[model samples]
Target: MALLDKLTSGSSTPPDTSGMSKQAKLVCELVADFNSNNLLTQIRNNNRSKSDIDKTYKYPDHFTSELIETKNFKMELLKWKNSHNPYVVLQFHGGGYVGAFKTQYRMFAGLYSELGKGASVLSIDYRVAPENPYPAALNDALYAYDWLLNHGYSENHIILAGDSAGGGLAMALCHYLTDRDRILPAGIVAMSPWTDLTASGSSYTENFEIDPLFGNTNESLIYNSVYPGNHDLTDPYISPLFGDFTGFPPMLIQVGSNEMLLSDSILVAEKAKSQGVKVRLSIYENMFHVFQMGMTLMPESKKAWVEVSKFLEQMMVL
Candidate 1:
């Protein structure tokens, strides 16, 4: 059951720099600088001034940023393209559930659209912690999903996907939908999903030195704190690894062998399999969290996208 010792056994290849537009390279550098300077942390800590902060930052293309109001709360939605039977992909972005914008995932939205054959993707900008506590983000995601269904999209045509925290949300949404007696989506894809908000997975220690995105246990604890309130982190709807996998749809999980969340994905896959849910897991060696974002430059990223596309095609035929 422990898959952590199985290394990728592959060589490290640089991302494809030739195909990258000058603007993209510039954006990557800027983001790298911002991350290095810990500006992202500053933004999250100062959530009270988000409006001014949002106005100062520039987002990438392929995502039209805007806000949507639901009965419970207001959240943002990132629209990729307009298409009939659009094969909608509801995306949740990763920022430890505290920071990160929809535009930061432009590469994913573009690749999903291209690989999914014109799928119109919408990345959810749910409420974050300290300001919005447990179930706030979950409620917003469910509301958006319901909006999509009401607007003519069938559950069978939708694909739930996300990276890091968003990946966890995808799994949580699946569990939530099933609980509501609603039809599940066509499929689900989680890239290094942070399934255990309690940070209780073994990889949190085993892969600590190997993971570059999250360096150590201390950092993981800080990220987990974003979720305010006394809710149980192990609640199946909160930490999907604890959720019932029975009656769930097919799933695809991709994670880096070096990520702290590696065990989280592995455990989810194991639980799904035990519950009779079809699951496919791809573990990329020497890769970091959400490494697929480098698809514009990384061969492995492209290959991962191809695998996801194949899974979606198979789900469509069912």
Candidate 2:
């Protein structure tokens, strides 16, 4: 059955992990009660610097990630031999604008590369906030896109993608490039994008109790301080949901049903569709944030990736 159908099936199960794989249920149970306040505190104090990107991240054994350095940050470019147009996914890693999980992003890039049937993946280490603050990440994203363009990758052959804050950055990058008349990517793929920094979405209150992450907690508020670094929560770049998507590229957004950020993804899809952008959204039933990152045994994760593969194929054809 289609993922969207799972949501619309109207089943009235009361369990939070309904429709989740047993493995996904376990994963959700682990984090549903957890909060990242301590972790954020450590990062804020610089006790947990993103040094893990170099020493801690393990690349998938299937491919080698080429390290490319810009003036300010390093990027991992995982190239695959495409069977069709030479395509690339310029990706961003999510850590709520403060955390850096290069290894996780590398693994995600591996999926994009494989699912894309040889499309290359270029994942960047954009500067995060509290240490780097707003606009820093966006600036680096722009540079990464430009690097691809300069290296012979056409805008239409490139896609912007990321999860969590990185996902929001992907959308915001389109806004920046679009406003400046820079070339936009062929499409966008966001997994539980935090597009609304304002935290104003109704989901914040609706899913507050059930969300496995950031549920009924102040963890997101900490990010507000360390990331946005200002009171301008509604800024289009800060919160891309407020940005115009009149001419943006096709977008594929996948979000878990129980995520507090569910509204973030849904609102963006509605806006994009209203503006005539082709959008495909899959709200996995009772799943949590970025459930695609869960263990491989999870059926939802695999299906979500299959959806990604399908989207990439369609983009190439277009």
Candidate 3:
């Protein structure tokens, strides 16, 4: 209750961290060390060369990722061996539009498959920013969706999912499809989606200290500078917080109550609900930025996926 008060108070300060779980506390400490060591700065500085980052985050042997290359872009399909699942999940990995490493994306796909029992996830490695920039990633997402459709999956059988920038990208893709009269997916699941590139949300300042991953406004500034080029931040295709969700399918938006992007999820749900869209917003108590990444250890993270599975199951049947 205190956490909710802090979130809705619109105060640009963080709440007490005394109630955080042991795992969450450890993650907060680890991320603090990570930031103090300037690891994120190094990653952003490395640009398109992921060799160093790749070495740091490799997928386990159990996960299978098949490489798919197109003339224009590339993606990976992650699932169990000989999976016959008819449903598919097209996932966009989050790295502030600057990072889309396979390790993180593959892990997410693996978790989805495990949770859904048989569904497979296609993680799209779209062109990143400060190099390919906007529309490049968006176009690649659309292309990957088309590739899935061409491979025999129907629009209703597919689900769009992502975190952070990728979550924003997923929303943008829905808008793009809706605008072009293309068939939409059955549902969407976004984890801590950065819907507003402008960083206008009150949570940006309110939950700053509690959010372990995002330290300050500089991270957003760096991502915004490289991503948008000369485009306005308010453009719905870029910052989906302003997009039209009138024709959008049912969406499940999850965010940590302690993260700065909390407002992004709240407002997006409000906006979608206003348009008569089915939107379910889950705000986890005491969780931080993309805390679901702690699925291997955190109980809250595991609970989050359970909720996701329930949502997917309910939506896919409709």
Candidate 4:
């Protein structure tokens, strides 16, 4: 198949990338080659252990790293200089509810600190599935939030962000908060979030053969692991694409035009808008899932983080 035909196939409209950065396109090709081993699937089927997913990036030495112990888990806190009302971004790492703590997450914490004005960052090493299932991670996230409040950080100081499964978790945390009539956070940032575990989105199949990490395979390796002894797939706390956004905070959602979860971000953006929530949605041309992780390596990724900065500034001002 010609390159143009491959570009136009099953992606969102226009599919035009004649003007796209050469580096962005290069990363796409590199990603395809890198994922040829099906690393994610190997982890899902227990062919690989969770320890294999704990890759870390070499981040700045200025930020302090601490393990905040809770009765159930240890939360990682990455912070620049500490001060009263210091900007805080509570993050969750994505691994399809299985993968955790990747190189990109550390990069994001550093980026958030620089962009968010010396922001303090926190990430929960939430429990994963085939071991600890539904409500476990969600419960851990709730504990993290309450832990912040009890320690004197206002809800206004926090902006939740995540990528892929972690992105869905960020939104689901808000759904959990709103339902309980708790104070909501400052905002949310999601990158190629997997909002529907059922793989109900048209893009799930439309982009199947093209999605570098998740194309044309048994999706059972996904939600089946996170929600094995399950409730309904559409349950707001699990899928979050079916979640409530009324009274939710401002949001920034970014997705790749080429990812299978493209529809996940689009659907949630529309839902949040309908419910009168503030929303900013951007779809990058000819990219892959969680491509923002490559911000250190690609212009498109850097561009997406710039959008995140603008949104964070706007949220802080409001």
Candidate 5:
């Protein structure tokens, strides 16, 4: 709590990188290395069965990871705790449609569940690209949303959220639902969303050097090919920056200043505001992509979690 307070309090100096300690840096680097080597290619291949893929990554304690087959596709769910009638927070894991799953985002689910206080956090593992492609993942998200609704969860008690690609999908799902006259969620949260499938954001170039995760242009190009092929990348459903924000539920967005996707979040916020949608955007200075993953270690990350929790609580009251 003290650490969170200190982080929330104003500080002039950039977070003391010197105090990061050798062990912490090594741990972060090791995680990054493991992700880059093993998981990156595995996700891109998209050849492994769902069970085989689940076996590859490590999940945190207390998370019940399981596969639930919906009507059209199979979706993986990561439940943080046992609950009856808990508010449902359905999260989509980020991988640019190629990388992460419930295991990689288990920590996020745990933090959200803890802060939400009696809420249930479920991270959805949708099909990836170069195989499943566009509309497949989007369809899976809609199916998951429908499943929640059919299982006795009310739309007013549900929150949709995700990071990176999953973040974009959350927005796209909302658009699709709204178009189909489905009930909107209570709220939405996106962490560093990649809103522009076209990769048209100026920050993509400006933040390239500072962003540790997506520094290489070729890697992004390769990823773009897998998901947005033959589709109009600028289509509102594909690039949410181009979507209609009218009549959507309240939204909270958090993005790191150093990420290549920074502009994507900014554009979405601006568009939402233009349409009079209630929106709150927090830009964390000097933080890397999805810095919230460092909540266990970094003060900034913990502060972000608290802010998101407060925002969701307020939305629930509306």
Candidate 6:
């Protein structure tokens, strides 16, 4: 309770991280001093053009990316040579449904190469909200999946992955496929997913100031508002936590204990397990939202991806 109060009140006193590794403790301290909410606000107001945003970053050299443009949408294929398996990951990069970063896609490609047995990733530049809300992203994700299927990838050879909002999108896509009786992917990997658009999770309030990325529930809610349009916030399409997962594929969800979205991942994992879905949930101690963003730099990030790879391998064996 003292640690909770210390964090919630923004006290300079550090929390009792006795059990955390030195690196994890350092990360916690660094994030505690950061003003992530202010950064989020600035990004929301920047209004930068796509080209301008694209100019800020580039894909990493570990993988090669090829642009595939369509009449309605564009996608990129992140390929690594000498892959160990035949798996295709359809990635939905997270940006609160308003924007995405090229750097994140490159990191995803790195994840695929390291933990996924050199699996190729198809990163979709799905439509975002406010400008393109609700069904637009859903439609684009479905189209990308169909493209994969039509291009010779069997349903069993494919896996779905996403971070934050994209994680929710991946799950929604699975829900859509199940409802319509389509074949499901082999498995799904969600990293710090925002499963509840209604912002009903307890961590929203309890972990507000403690969460280094989101900072508070309202910040997440602002992003949520632009996407739902007139749709019900609790609609299973928007909040997959409310949906039934009777026949869903095996899933692995990773979230940081200090994140405001912690409860979102917890509740969804419970829901999936109740409906007989194979679910693996990892809660990293002393970490923040989407801590995997640090990737190779953070030990927790490396461990998370290793778990993801193990999960993928297990699913493939089933």
Report, for every candidate in turn, its global Cα lDDT versus the true structure: 0.69, 0.78, 0.78, 0.75, 0.72, 0.76
Error of 2 at 90 (Å): 0.6
The pairs that clash in candidate 1 are 15-297, 16-297
Worst 10-residue lDDT window for candidate 4 reads: 1-10
lDDT of 2 by residue, 114-143 (tens): 767678889888887667888788899889
Please identify model 4 stretches exceeding 4 Å from their true place.
1-20, 38-59, 82-85, 219-224
TM-score of 1: 0.78
For residues 134-239, write the lDDT of model 1, one tens digit per residue: 7877887788788889877888888888888788888888889888888998888888888887777898888876565566437543245657478888887678
Error of 2 at 97 (Å): 0.4
Per-prediction TM-score, please?
Answer: 0.78, 0.87, 0.86, 0.86, 0.81, 0.85
Worst 10 residues of 2 by lDDT: 1-10
Question: In candidate 5, which residue ranges exceed 4 Å CA deviation?
Answer: 1-67, 71-73, 76-86, 221-223
Lowest lDDT 10-mer window, candidate 3?
1-10
- Candidate 2 — which residues are off by over 4 angstroms? 1-18, 33-48, 56-62, 81-85
Ranking by lDDT: 2, 3, 6, 4, 5, 1
Best by lDDT: 2
Whole-model lDDT for model 4 versus the true structure? 0.75
lDDT of 6 by residue, 203-231 (tens): 88888877766674464543446888899
Candidate 3, residues 162-240: lDDT per residue as tens digits?
A: 9988899999999999999999999999999989988888887898766666756455442345788889989999999
Best model per TM-score:
2
Q: Is candidate 2 or candidate 6 better by lDDT?
A: 2
